[model samples]
Target: MKRLYQTVPTGCDWAVEAQGLVKTFGDHRAVDGVHLKVRTGTIYAVLGPNGAGKTTTIRMLTTLLRPDDGSARIFGYDVVKESHIVRQLIGVTGQYASVDESLSAIENLVIFSRLLGMGRKEARQRAEELLEEFSLTEAANRPLKNFSGGMRRRLDLAASLIAQPPLIFLDEPTTGLDPRTRNQMWETIRKLVNHGSTVLLTTQYLQEADELADRIAVIDRGKVVAEGTADELKASVGNSSLQLKIQHSYDMERARQIVEQVLKVRSNTSTETGRITAPMTEADRVTDLLIALREAGIHLAELSVQKPTLDEVFLTITGHGVKKDTAVDSSSAVEEVRV
Candidate 1:
């Protein structure tokens, strides 16, 4: 297949690169030998379940936590030796809202701008422009304590972009948001890329990574177990399958029997979707199934080919579904960790 974007033609093309990155706390290895090569002007997702060492990796890449081993560069600057330069080029935001509750929306943005070395007039102008861009101008003067979760999330992102950094690190920025709000956050991330920014995202929401990331690295047990585009990862797990909705509950048994005999593989059905799925191949075709079912006097409500999902890919690679945890001190630990 044709490549989607141009490969890095020169040494300066990468936005972030690392090799053999390892971090340990006493006997525990939070991040073990993690590596990455993120391109310029695209979204790269580090996808993993909690306690999978995602936050520890971000800390090393952003120069917040010193790595016990390995090294990394951000747009040609060393994360450790040249951390000051790295800081100037990148923005980091995490799960928690970082704005002061007592401050107004405009006030929060202006403060960030000021901290970034903007003069009084410049800071005010930048804050106003960002408030407008993020669609928060209507509530710019309202205290942050009154802002909704979505509004506060947007404001936090705006603050991170105050200096217009070339690269941004978003550590699960959409966790705990309503569907509409999550979509809004996704749009905001896309807008950042459209404006010539490179983003490195860490997320457990498989769908979020599937939607936003141009490429993905699935981390399990503090190391990258898989890396590719969403489709590539999904394709790696298994083949596309045929999904059928039986017209009646009684038809399910007959359909399953016909499908098994035709495909020579076991079939699985779900009570929730009222669907049965089996691997799709030329030998197990819709026409053949329909013909066989017609002779057997069985009917199906729907039939379609379905590809594997990222969630399925995760379970396949990791051997289990992701277990949720909120304990900050644990291996999963991610909540606005800063530099």
Candidate 2:
């Protein structure tokens, strides 16, 4: 099976490199000629809707499945020919939390550390260190069944880091968590990168990618439709809008009128958000709008220049919004891999 994708090797400084990667299942081309070059010690995010070939791409790069075409390298080692070496350099946290339901947090980390060839005493020490790092020291002795969602996630992350691999693959690590827990996980990921780990993250949440990714690649129908930093991608949309919120409801109509008269373009008002949004045709439109509004005595609660959202970007790329129902879970994705 390994021989299928194994080919001539290449050299690279990237923490991860894949070129023209392809995968198929019977008639389905789950992954289609995807290419990715992730810089070392930074976070790269892959975001797409359900069944968008995200999981299949991850499986190929992780050496869990042979690609139908193309090649991938991990830290300059070919994923296929040097799979053992590749695996040695990386750790994976799947979409779902993988900690043992019955094991205590400390026990889980200890076992993982021991498996990474630590001695009993060394394992114990490492376990304690990780427990503190993840802020789970208080629950270290409690069975994981009693742990909250956030604690379990942190523990799962700690276990995956037992070997301190240089590169980590996280597939939707924040799925199914509340906003607070999700934020905590985001911080943990940032801390990992700060301490010198390169992360390749796949997620359905646009905001997650916006907040955490140093670079984002959007995949659809197994193709990379776009790739750039959040700001770069937004700027690529090629238009900015003057966004204004008036302090009083009575000022909405006046504010709208002032914006339309200044920009010479129709403005929209959202009753829900009380915002007047209009596209800016000139470079100084927002500034012009501000001065005009102030002259007219329209006090604003908020004013800013706005670009298209990641959500809007995705819609433009894929011709639809993300369908959470179409999202393939990790376990199901793994099971669908063809040899």
Candidate 3:
């Protein structure tokens, strides 16, 4: 609840702040001392595998669930003590669409706007604009029951932005959408920030976090295993990634061993492609590696060095791949105190 910044930069304003937040459901400590600082008007992503407490952390910060320990402030307003004020400052869109099944798209948006205290005419106008912006004007009159998953997702986003609150919490906005539709959602999310709305989203898609977030926190088993920019997290894994394509398929294992010995790091070999990949702390080590490979009669067809990807960073930090599953914070058991 208090504005405290021991680790965050001094000059920036945080849209959401929480420190040592904890939550438990019987035996499982769902959220274990999670901490986050989202800068105003930036996209901050929480990336984690399933059941990693990403949703629990979001619920605590958004005042949907009470934390057993620590505290959080939304725009300097306490989520626990100043929940009413905090609610006014934010919007939340969960994974599932929260709209009336019998209502049309326009009707749903208008209803949401009106519920937020907008006049009927103003609500209708706002609904139309949102429908147009989300490219759902053609289906504005279609019933929600007939809408596709992507359409419903977009409408859900539009409903959440009816008031255009300062901060928005999106729990995997692009889940279950087609590639094209997912890209559209990404653009909309970017536009939200461009128009001065801060976004805090949780996603298991490593590429989504890498593409959308200004900063990312990787949570695993209810703990923040890593936090930083995509580049920073990647650098934490390795300074650069070295990739080698062997001239002979049978030589891949030998090449991998040579690479591991020369680079002094573990290397992965692809039997099919005759490729060897390893992390590199020094780029200059490539010369020695090439010499060693040549002496060992291992010829390289191609070679390259690049930064580590978010997938690699996830594997390195969490020791597992990302799992695509709905985050269960058990919010259904707790009566939602909607604002």
lDDT of 2 at 324: 32
Listed per candidate, the RMSD to the true structure in angstroms reads 9.5, 9.2, 8.9
For residues 1-339, what per-residue lDDT tens digits would candidate 1 score against the true structure?
A: 221122223457789988779999999999998878888999999999888999899989999999999889898889999999888888898668878999999988887888788888888999999999989999999998888888988998998888778889998888788999899889999998998889999998767898999988888778877777776565444456678898888777778889867765456677667788765535336677779888998877888887655445555555432222211122221111111
- Residue-level lDDT of model 2, residues 234-284, one tens digit each, is 443325666788888888998888877877765668867888776565867
Per-residue lDDT, model 3, residue 226, is 74
Where does candidate 2 have its weakest 10-residue lDDT segment?
1-10
Residue 121 lDDT in candidate 1: 85
Q: Per-candidate TM vs. native? A: 0.74, 0.71, 0.78
What lDDT would candidate 1 get against the real structure? 0.78
Give the distance in Å from residue 127's predicted Cα in candidate 2 to where it truly belongs: 1.2
Local accuracy of candidate 3 as per-residue lDDT tens digits, 21-96 = 8999999999988777787889999988778899899888888999999899888889999998787778899878
TM-score of 1: 0.74
- Number of clashes recorded per candidate: 1, 0, 0
Best by TM-score: 3
What's the CA RMSD of model 2 in angstroms? Answer: 9.2
Residue 42, model 2: Cα distance from true site in angstroms = 1.5
Ranking by lDDT: 3, 1, 2
